[model samples]
Target: MPKTILILGASYAGTATAHYALKHTIPSLPDPSSFEVVLVAPSRHALCRPATPRALLSDDFFDQDKLFIDVEQQFKQYGERFRFVHGRATRLDTEGRVVSVELVKDAGEGEVTLEVAYHALIIATGSSTPSPLHGLNSSGRDELRAHWTAFRAALPSAKTIVIAGGGPAGIETAGELGEYLNGRAGWFSSKLENPKVKLTVVSREEKILPLLRPSIAQTAEGFLAKVGVDVIRGVSVDSVSPPDGGRGEGGSLTAKTEVKLSNGQTLAADLYIPAYGTIPNTGFVPEGLRAENGRVETNPQTLRVEKAGERVYAVGDASNYARPAVHLIMEVIPVLAANIKRDLLRAAGESPSGEDRVFKEDKREMQFVPIGRSKGVGAAMGFRVPSLLVWLIKGRDYFVSMAGKMWNGQHWAKET
Candidate 1:
């Protein structure tokens, strides 16, 4: 008779929680089988979101659903201790401990409430990548991938390229295309159908990577420069529209909308890509919950959405525990799992004389960042491991194989 814990969103944070709890944390607690862990997500597989860039050049990467992870298979080694639900959550009641989960299929979704009551809940819906890639598509597994596929199809023929938003996504897209076009940073030894493809990044901010320290930000800017990316900083656009009534291809109907800059400048391209920012996907959380900046805001240390009365938590992009970073998920999810078990211990009246084990003051630290696939920057395990580690950790195969290994003998588990 284990208490149930329902986890939402099954990407990095959610996946890590399930794996850690099922394999490590839960077993460490008393009567592990008494604490059933249930994971709910939109899909059955965990997608390797970072590799969407490589998929642009390599057709072998286009196995769209192939990259997805099977949660059941991923955690099967844990036996009947875990359950995965494929559905979209409609609402949550942290107070009463109930979640309204909707089972979505091809044509329609079947609605139902979970039978078990939760001793704790983990929301790890993660972030999506759109302009800033702040949504489901931003993970580089969705619309952005589709957009790149379309852009690459026309690349060999296009003469100009204009990218909006100077964030990492914008820079990454520019870098990859430049590499593909010239074959090298050196124009001398390269094969290019067009060496003069106009690449411009428009950002309203005075500098790029605003969240990063100025020095580190400049380092990124320099990297972009080395790759021959033209960055346009501090210029906003009033509206986005095509001039001369759309040229080439299918115009607005088939192609992206032309942009009109606020500086009274008209910029058009064979392809227009938006690398904007992220917004919260808490619409599924119903009402009365605290969500801000298009994301749910919670105390970093506690991970409590508003009050800490019930067993509740949010992780990854869906919950803005103050700052958002992919690497943070690595740190936060483990802390989150530990905290949940601690809460369960306290709730079961199994605490050690008023000492609270459930606390959430985890620090936010970024360890690795890969620019493209081969090169980038980062610091890991407290060594500032350099960009080379980034290449190995994420740049190489985009950690697709590592993700499989995390599942303990399934997925890309054997591919490596």
Candidate 2:
């Protein structure tokens, strides 16, 4: 009887753990058949969300067909050793070590239910962004593509675009819009003289990209200004009328929005995009194992869910780890895979407690904020890099190739 290792969410962290465990653990096990890895997620494909800011504004930048990779196709070579369940995990039974999922693609029935028991569970459900930027909201590839189509159709006619939040998403969006209206990039013709062609970014923080150093943040601000993006800092969006509305049915806004700021001012725009970061998708996570914001609480060193015993772990946005990114998730996978292997070995009566591996998040945080296809800003290994370097490293392709690697070469094909 193989010990089933069930993983929740097939986003970056969850999928990486599955692949690493298969590559590292099975061969080392005394009996390779002693364990099986099962990955459960809402979508049957991986959405390349980082490209959303650019893609939503312009079609030439990214191919919608390549934005997602079918989950099954990416792991087909692994054979029966791995399994991908296309469903949402609605309930978790910690005591029984079982998870209840509602299948996304059921054939005959109204709703399909599945119960999977596991020796270990990894949560990597990721997170969701607000509308007009449904970057991580859809459950499948088709739905995600639909979201992009809607956004593109809505953007062309819009004369004014207001973005809330000064994080990477907001800043990137405003940058792209600024360039589009300036006739620098994108398909939109130059509206340089059109006062109606407005682009603004509102941030609660005093500076944009607060996670970066003041100098780096300033560099980003300078670039945005050059592209005609108006920056408003130290205030938040208090309310948006047509509040829940966005571009269309699938987006957050159905029509133009009248936005109210915390400072008691109003700004009306043709489009409003919220880039305030993600809302954790941990609703199914047990309250005891979760933090205030519903992110799983994990032991800093071990990366195991705090107070949820050694069998459960979490990573990416679903975990308490702040600022989840593809780079960080890749960094955390090895340690997480090793820790799970150690636990399995102990269960098999092989390793002792002292020999168990533990994970530590990289202390030196890093990120790249691309303004458009040819210019941007970034910090790597605690040092800021110039815009040209940012463009060469990430801005050009927006790390589409990296996303391709995540999907195992099925999407975002490399140029030969």
Which candidate number maximizes TM-score?
2
Per-candidate clashes, comma-separated: 20, 7
Deviation (Å) of 400 in candidate 2: 0.7
Per-residue lDDT, model 1, residue 12, is: 75
**Per-model TM-score on C-alpha atoms:** 0.79, 0.91
Give per-residue CA lDDT, model 2, range 11-91, as digits (tens). 778777777777776666678887888988878877777777777666677765577667777777778898888889988
lDDT of 1 at 255: 54
Off by over 4 Å in 1: 28-31, 60-67, 107-117, 131-151, 187-196, 213-216, 226-228, 242-254, 352-394, 407-416
lDDT of 1 by residue, 19-64 (tens): 7777666776777778888988776667766665555555574455
Please list all clashing residue pairs in model 2, or write none if there are none.
245-252, 245-253, 245-254, 246-252, 246-253, 246-254, 247-253
Candidate 1 Cα RMSD after full superposition onto the native fold (Å): 5.3
Best by lDDT: 2
